[model samples]
Target: MSGTVIATHGLRKAYGAVRAVDGIDLDVRAGDIYGFLGANGSGKTTTVRMLLGLVLPTAGTVEVLGRPIPKAAREVLPRVGALIEGPAAYGHLSGTANLSLLDAAGPGGSRRTRKARIAEVLEQVGLGGVGKRAVRGYSLGMRQRLGLAGALLRRPDLLVLDEPTNGLDPQGIHEIRLLLLDLHRTGTTIFVSSHLLAEIEQLATRVGVLDRGRMVLQDDLATLTAPTGATVVTTTDPAQAARVLGDRVLTSDGERLVVRGSDPAEVNTALVGAGVPVTGLVLQRPTLEEVVLAAATGSGDRVAA
Candidate 1:
């Protein structure tokens, strides 16, 4: 966990002529809650599967926890916990019983440690009081929490979750977000995949955007959501302001000037000095959703500093 917790070089996965995951490279740092974001069918889940050795890459290399993947999956996977797709549990079984079964079936599991581990995880997920409740009676959010608890049983250094909040309501989503934040504060490196830009914006330290099996962007959330060189300036005399601003002016409707990539101070000074009375000016900062949309659609030239 000193360097990259997950790294991929030229990763590819194809079926017949369809490439679900094209050649892509990734570097997920230790302790980072890296969001693997994309639209539906953008290969986010495929990428996570490759990392967990659940799906074999058609070509290229993968390393997880500093060890080569698939080849070292046996040695590496135990240290990495995952909750892919959704909760895999029996509806008829009690919450405690389900966790016990899954853990016992996994490698290194033993009857001696199973009970304590189950109780510990149930409490960690806020399900301690309902440990004996049937899974069929649990809400979707509760089930999600239970799934997360199972993944945490190993106390893995890396936790990989695919669309963790797929169908949750607002409250459920909020609960999951809080849980993820708590885990992150405790120093778990989380690699979560989701199609919702807003969801990722809330929790990811860094983001990797995918589109149609190809990676379009990867950077810090701050870097990706910075100002995009757009500004709005209002003046008493719009015609005069437009003439003074010249080509830097993107648009004007005889009242305000929509300028591109110019400082507000400079714009005000130029307008006032040119005999145009400046009324108001504001610099526009692009939102995370805007940036994600631009990148996902391949319309963005670069992220503004």
Candidate 2:
């Protein structure tokens, strides 16, 4: 009933004295590729589990697709698909057979077209031909694809994926990214929990960064990575360009200069007019990784003496 497909406030999860997820709010808008970012031990998995009602929160609330979790899990979860951590299946069963069993247990899928749906999803995830292969014989990447096929079996409106590309090779990862983008184009709201900054940087419209069980930053990716009023100029004559720019120059390497100006066009004009050879000029923007690192503390996976 709200604009946000996933909304949380003060969401917390604790294991005895250890607070796995300290109070954090997550806002995932409809039609957003919301990238949930965190270092290891940052509680991203815990938060994701809570979002799906797999783990109970010690405090706060989680609403997915406008419904409260656990209380409304039966109704809500059917419309939501999730792949948490990785996936599991009967090693003895073929991928298709495994999906058949999973599909039968769920309520939303119609038994009449279950086989057809399974086949469709298998194809969607690049496992169509291998659906008949025993899961034990499938490679890790194939298993991952089969798991994704399972998640998309019912065509849920919201996809909550945790490291969806885990164990995938470069090609497999690229294919999955394309698939996710295609899904997003068709109106599925995606909440991706991943540590792969490069993938997230390419896919996410909004990003939330977590560090040591706390949310350090949450904003539109564009806002977080916006230009910092600086222009980067690459020139064969860096010294001459810097001289022409004067105090506007921030830093200079052998061939590139960081200028204290937001408009690269203006800088380019000045350089060109001053007879300085400008090879390239562009606005300097912080990358998604830079913004995330600036927000979050050091990785929690580290143990220092």
Candidate 3:
């Protein structure tokens, strides 16, 4: 929970002529609820696969739990639990049976303690009541929880999840979010990939954004979502204010002007000097979705700043 738990340098992956992940450097500190964000086909999944040793990187290096990955995968993987794509399950098998099979294939989980561990994770993910039900009969939400429970069975130090809330309803999504928070509180370093910005906003202590196979931004949630010069200035006379403000105006209605990259004091001083009555000035902060879209589209130079 102190040093870097996951580190990557110039990480890249290519297929034929396509570069799925370009030269990138990333760091995930211990005990961080790190949210990995990107549009569809933005190499988020590919990056994760490389981290887990499921897919080897074509260039650069990866380290997880402070050890080189793939090389140290034998020692590193046992301490990590992951739920990628979706839960792999036998549709005919009951939930408990599926966990039993997975635990058998997994590393270092003792048979004697396995029963109690499985029950513990099932209850943690709110699937205790349905552990005996056939997985095919459970709802999509239930299946997702079961997948998460399977991951938790190892009592991993790092939990890696890719799009864990992809197909969940509102209630299910909330439950997962709560579960993740609980895990974070218990000193688990969670690296999660998701397209759901609001959900990420609620859970992530830090975030990394990928756009077109390149990392555009990575920072703490608070700084990344902080206000970035999109301010609202209200006035009695919008036309006068616009003329005084000149090119600083972004958009203007009859009563207010939404200006960009201008200080409120500067705006107010200019308006007052020009004989425009300033009624109010309020700073409007950009939302996480706004900042992310801006960076993804190359419209924002530095969203976090």
Candidate 4:
């Protein structure tokens, strides 16, 4: 088996004449909380479906859990659990009943072991006492938790969740965040897809960015969030400062200049020597949103949606 729990090469999928997922590659290691990020219609869903063997790829090789996908999905899937798009549960059934049904259908295990596993997962996902309530009566967050518990019924080594935090209130989101952290600590590899940059920033150790059916960027969260040198903003003549700074200037935000690749001392030396006023100089660190947008657009422009 390779070091990566999930690996893909030249992965491609098309719907009719439109290429939903272009040739792409990915490597996700065990115990990683890899975030799949993209805007609406950016092919994130398609890519995930292909990975899970739900959608056949037109081209490329895919491997999950050390087995070739689709052909090996039946054997490999037993060790994988997924909650795609949203939670799946019988609305009329109580949470505990729903879990029981899933547990019965999952891979072979002793009856007592299965029951204990179900109970443990229920508690892990924060649905302990509420398991007796009908799924329809549960709140959106509770439903999400129940679905997660069902996925855990098989004791899967890998968990794939899509927009798991959608429709969750702030407190619910916090709860899920903590739950995921705990799961990661226990050596479960989590693969999550989300459009919410803030949520991904908080939970993901690494990120894969998709745009218009192409992967624009993939990197560790720390590198993506690190300061790209100093962004010195000044209240001097912007045009002249920009010319002096040349390619080092990132942009001008109304009466202030955003310079990159230059430290404060270098920026000040150039500005003061050029006879530019030193009214104000402030350094700014780039946010995750900024980093994602820059990579997606191939420019420093603000992202739409």
Candidate 5:
């Protein structure tokens, strides 16, 4: 609870000659919305499996909640909730029925409290009104919600979700993001694995980039997107601003100029000293996209010669 929720040391998984997951170290601390990013075949899924003890590593170690996985799985897994490779349930069963059966099968949540827990999770996933409706009648988005509901039924301390917003429309995606943020505010550590950079940028407090089975980068989102000691100035006459700042100006597009300095106040004072009227002053920070592009070579699905 106080330290890492999930940690990996030199984790590797190889099939014959193909190394699906090469040497990689993962560090996921409690209270972190850790975004696990990679392209389609970057071994992201494999790594998630290993962390959850669904798949074994070829070499190295994995620990979840400060306990070694698969070794102490019986004791540790109950505190973890996951939606991996999507959710599966009997298509003929109602969402409530499916959850009831799952809760009965899993540890915790007694038979007496099953109904209340199911209702809570169903409502949490926005399916509170789908009373007794067969899952087969549900849409892909609804099924995804059902999957998430299952993961949340346990009120887990850690949530591992893969492409959590998959199959949802824009509004649904927005709702899920808000739901996740709300959960984080209450103190659940979340590990979200997805290629959706925009969502990750919005939600993740920390991120880890995977490329060709290797961990290329892992750090806090704030650190990754920290200001690059550059300031952006918006002025009517960019020419005068650039001339005022001289070589300190990096680029000028439209009314905006990118200047090579961290302090906006200093740049503003310099521009005002030169009689350059400034409309706006802002700091230049790297976007999550820019950070990932620099850390990982091409995406997971990049074609090679």
Candidate 6:
């Protein structure tokens, strides 16, 4: 937690002839909710397993909480909590019982302390009275909350979650988002991996997009979503506007025109001078979906067609 909560240098991993993670580098700052986003089979899970010491890397150095991974994971893992792939709990046991079992197997703490901690975490995760319910009887969202409570039992400094909201309803997703925001407010560094771009757009401060075992983009959400000085305009005369703008025009949307490299004043001036009346104009901001598609296709230009 001093310098970087998670850092990897030239991380590489291969399976037979296929390279899953190809010399990827990462630096996750303390107290940040870094979103690790990628398509299916894009090595997101592979990289996460390496960080947790569940799988060995072919080459590279990994440090979590300022200690080397796998070698020091045993020492460092106690201060870290994770819910990868899915929740881990016995179907036969009740939610409360599962938490108790984890508490006993975890770090050294008195029985009374453990009990109090369990109740506190259960409430924090919005599962206060449902602890007595059997795990098998609980809904998918309820199970997700229970899993998060188990992870928070130790009050870890760094939390890694994979698809945390995978099997949730809209309300359940909203609840989990609020819970994550609360945790981040309390100084916990969260590393979440998900295939849902919109979820990451709302929850994460910074994001890293991966495709085909390579990182296509890594930047803050604000930077990625900022207006790229492009405008989409609906006009009375599309043909006349295109002819006037010529090569400066990027594309057309049948009735509208996408013009690049022109400020608002200049766009208005050119349109009015050419006898083209503007019906509507909207400044375009890149969406996460758009950015991800652009990165995947290796096309830097914004698509307006």
Point to the candidate with the largest lDDT. Answer: 5
User: In every candidate, how many clashes are there?
Assistant: 0, 0, 0, 0, 0, 0
Error of 4 at 279 (Å): 16
**Alpha-carbon error at 129 in model 4, in Å?**
1.6
lDDT of 2 by residue, 16-97 (tens): 9998998999999999999999876779999999998889999999988888986899989988888999889999999999
* TM-score list, all predictions: 0.82, 0.95, 0.83, 0.81, 0.95, 0.85
Task: Sort every candidate by TM-score, greatest first.
Answer: 2, 5, 6, 3, 1, 4
Error of 6 at 269 (Å): 8.2
Against the correct fold, how does model 3 do in TM-score?
0.83
Q: What is the Cα-based TM-score of model 1?
A: 0.82
Which tens-of-lDDT digit does each residue in 224-299 have in candidate 3? 8777677789998999888877888999888989987547887778789989998899787777898788777673
lDDT of 1 by residue, 1-305 (tens): 57899999999999899998888899899888999987777788888999988899999999999999899988998788899989988999999999988887788667887889889888877799999999999988789889988999888889999988866788778878888888888889999999877888999999998887888888988888777687788887887787887898888877877897658998888778878888888887666788777786573432222
List ranges where model 6 is wrong by over 4 Å. Answer: 108-110, 234-249, 261-281, 299-305
lDDT of 6 by residue, 158-183 (tens): 99998888788988888888989899
Candidate 6, pairs of clashing residues: none
For residues 121-222, what per-residue lDDT tens digits would candidate 5 score against the true structure?
899889999947999999999999999999998889999998989999999999899989999999999999999998999999999988888888999999
In candidate 4, what are the lDDT values of residues 153-250, reduced to their tens digit? 77778998888887789887888889888888878899998899998889999889988778888888888877767666676588888888888877
lDDT of each: 0.85, 0.90, 0.89, 0.83, 0.91, 0.86
Q: Count backbone overlaps in model 2.
A: 0
The model with the greater lDDT, 5 or 6, is: 5
lDDT of 3 at 57: 95
Q: Where does the lowest 10-residue lDDT sum fall in candidate 4?
A: 296-305
Which ten-residue region of model 5 has the weakest summed lDDT?
Answer: 296-305
